[model samples]
Target: MQRFTARAVVVGDRAGTVVPDAVLDVDDGEIRWVGPAADAAPAPDAETVDLPGVLLPGLVNTHSHAPMVLFRGQAEGLPLDRWLGEVIWPREARLTGDDVEVAMTAASAEMLRNGVTTSVEMYFSPERIAAAVTATGARAVIATPLIPLPGMPPLEEQLQHSVELAAGTPTGGTVEYGLGPHAAYTLPLSILTSAAAAAREHNLLLHLHVAETATEGDELLARHGLSVPTLLAAHDVLGGRVLAAHCVHMDDADLELWQEYDVAVAHCPASNAKLASGVMRLREMLDRGIRVGLGTDGPASNDGLDLLADARLAAQLARLREADPTALTAAEAFWLATGAAADAIGRPDLGRLTRGRQADLVHVDTRDLRFEPVGDKEDLLTHLVWSGITPLVRDTWVAGRQVVRDGVCTTVDAEALRADVAERAARLAHGG
Candidate 1:
């Protein structure tokens, strides 16, 4: 057992509760108790550690292709379609399992150092991705990629393999499995339904891209005369743990479909803006009770893996879209990266400082120059979302085990991983 007392503990609940002088107790990789120190029970047998800063639930990245870090800052000044069709796909075609493992190891270490403990990963090489996350002591939900590209197996074979992977993974563990159909435009309706059915059978998450750009679904719409969301509904693929990424071009009817089917959205503001994709109707979605979480997309697209930066960008874009500064408050923005994000991903065990939740915690050093004049609880939470505090993440813990300390990953060698990723990325860039 371990007891950690911090200057402030951000509960990360929907209400954005913050406790001053709080105590968080952990046992067997789960939170045993968390509340004000005055209301805690005595646990003399537990090792005690005092944190001289704010403690928050580790941020949840609802969508990511982390291994794409190998292509970060490449193919710049290109739109989404040209970017993928011209550069990304060709480079990805040459990816080996070892390349994926090494890249994911480095990416996992980068995210952990930035206080992202768990991420929803959709990339090739599921076993290698799992091995990388496990090696770094980080948590991940590996959504098996089911894209219909050249040199890849048929959709039926891919679906069967996804089912096998999900069936083999233990539920509610550090590593989970899901189904990631690349997108509606890239796949057929029959295959989409089949993938959703397989996900339902195994009780796994169904993640996919939907309506990212204005014309991504034009061909499908021309053929079926229905929007992507409605076509998905017609084929019975709307419900059952579906998580749609980049819902930047959705309309009222599409939003209605999401509400009706209880589908969640993974909003990637940074990537959307970078690719010239229009802003999502965040206020409208939230008003209609749609579960929305922030995502960094791929490291190559967003050019970084900082979920806090995405959270801040999400708030900024929402406010600009609504033409109201108060459209999304700082507290709400932070929640989108933490507790609400966990809910969007359907992981109730993460993203909270309550009893029975996984002890994935982040320590933000308040002594940093950026965090000044700690006025009140609201101010603290506001600073967390609004300020440039990514570099202030001093330590991080996943399931009660410290993985990052003093802004460094304790589980992985940062220097060696950087050198290895650079070499592999150079070879990949040259089409090898």
Candidate 2:
């Protein structure tokens, strides 16, 4: 058992409560208690660590391709279609299992140092990805990509592999698996419908990209005589549990369909803007009572995995799109990265500092000028959302295990990992 005393604790619950002079107790990888330090009375033999900073739930990234760290900064200014077809897909075709393992290892370390404890990963090589996550001690929900490509197995074979992975990795642990159908543009209607049926049969989360850009919607509508969402509805693909990413081009009808189907949206504001995709209708989504959460998309697209910066960008974009200063509050943005993200991914046991929740927390050093003039508990969250950076994270823990301390990752050899990735990335860049 262990107890941590901090200056403040941002309990990322539904009400967004904050406790000052907080004490958090952890036992067997679960939070045992959370309250004011003055009221805590631990056993005599328990260990205690006093910290001079604000404690908050570690950020949850609702969508990402973790192994894309090797492709970061490649195809710099290209839009989504050219970027994927010309740069990304060609290189990804040559990726091996070891390549995915090393890249995801570095990505896990980077995310942990930035205070993101849990991430939803959609990529190939699920077993290798899971091995990397296990080695780094990071929590993840990995979804196998279900797109058919040349020189690859048939669609049925791919689906069977995904189901096997999901069955082997059940929920309630540090890792989970799901089905990821790339998108309507890349996959046919039969494949999409079959994937949805498999997901329903296995009771797994169906994650995919949808309505990412105007070009995508235009192409789909021109070919199918219906919008992307409407086409999905016609095939009965939207009736199951879904986590749709990059919903930047959704219309009112699409929004209504998503709401009726109770689909969750993973809003990747930074990636969307970087790729020249329009901003999502965040205020409208919230107003319609739709579930929306924050995502970093991928290191290649966003060029960074900082969820705090992504939160700030989301708030700014929401305000600009709505032409209202109060379109999205800092607290609301913070919630998108934490509690709401967990909900979007269907992980109720994470993204909060409360009894029975996982002991995944981050300690932010508030002694710097970035957090100057700290007024109240509310101000802490505002500062974290607007001014927080990777350097502010002093310590990070996942499931009662301290993965990072004093701004260093304990589970990964970052220096060696970076060197290896540099060589591998160069080879991939040269079309080896």
Candidate 3:
């Protein structure tokens, strides 16, 4: 049992601001109490940490490939398809379980240091990914990598392998499993049907890359005489349960389909912009009451898997698209990254600091010169959003355990991970 009292906290809300003299209490990894500091009833012998600056729920990266940090900035100037074929796919084929564990540990270490506690991971070797996340005590949704290319194993075999991998994982504390069916372009109709059936059988949410590029949408349209969303709907894949990443090229009909299916969107603005993928209709989606969360697609495309930077980019892109300053307010941007993201991953128990929720949080040291006065609600949020306080986060915690302390990771050695990353990345760069 422990109690933490902070001078102020940006409580997750639609109101879009902070609260002064906030107090938060945790027990067995869940928030037992929370309120104004003056009104807090804390135990005398309970361990307490005085966070005088600011405490907020840890940010969630709704989409990522954890071990792909080994490929960051490798194919710098290529588009999504060319980049994947020329550099990403070839390197991924060479990875072993040991390599995945090492690289994912490195990537997870980076996210912890950057105040991301819950991540949505889609990659190869999900067993290793789950192991690293469980050992580290962070939260994640590890989707089994589902490929539909030629010369591949049967769909049943793939599902069985995924079930086997999931069975070995005891991530019940903070990890969940989902189906990762690469995309509509790569997966055949039969394979997709099988994947959807597996997802329904397990009652798991489906995470997929959809309408990521113009070319992808075009190919699906020509082959099926319909959009990807239509195909998915026909196959019963898009329900209130799907987390669709990078829906950048959806038409109005597709948007209607998303609303009908109750699908959530993981908007990766930085990656979309960098890859020359068109900007998503986020404002329109939100207007239609579609759930949307923020994601830093991957380190290779975004060049940084940081959700604060992602939030900043989301707001900036909205403003750029609408040519209006009031496009996405700071509070809304924060929600998209944290609370909304948690909802997208089907973890409503997270994303807030209210009583009875998980104690996944980050403490930001606001005594720095950037935030002159942060006690008030709007000013604190303005400073946090507009003044660039994301880089000033000092610590992060997930499941009531400290993962990053004093801006450093407590689980993995950063220096060692960096050395391993450098060595592996060098080999890939030289095509050895």
The estimated TM-scores of all candidates read 0.99, 0.98, 0.96
Taking the tens digit of each residue's C-alpha lDDT, what string does model 2 give over 273-373? 99999999999998898888899999999999999999999999999999998999988888899988888888889888889999999999889898887
Off by over 4 Å in 1: none
The residue pairs that clash in candidate 1, if any, are none
Q: Point out the worst 10-residue segment of candidate 1 by lDDT.
A: 368-377
Tell me how far candidate 2 lies from the true structure as C-alpha RMSD in angstroms. Answer: 1.2
Q: Candidate 2 at residue 163, lDDT?
A: 87
Summarize candidate 3's per-residue lDDT along 1-432 as a digit string, tens digits: 888888688876657657688888899988988878888885898898988678888888899987888888888889889998988888776777877888888888888877889899998778788788876667888888788544557766876787666555565567788888888888777777777777777767778999999888777688779889898899777764689999988889999999887898999999999999988888888889888999998888888878888888899999888888988988988889888888878888888777788899899888898888645567877777777776788888897899888888888778988998889887766776
Clash total of candidate 1: 0
Candidate 2 clash pair list: none
Ordered by lDDT, highest first, the candidates read 1, 2, 3
Cα RMSD for candidates in order: 0.8, 1.2, 1.7
Please give the distance, in angstroms, between residue 38's alpha carbon in candidate 1 and its true position after superposition. 2.1
Instruction: Provide the overall lDDT of each model, using Cα atoms, as 2-decimal numbers.
Output: 0.93, 0.90, 0.83
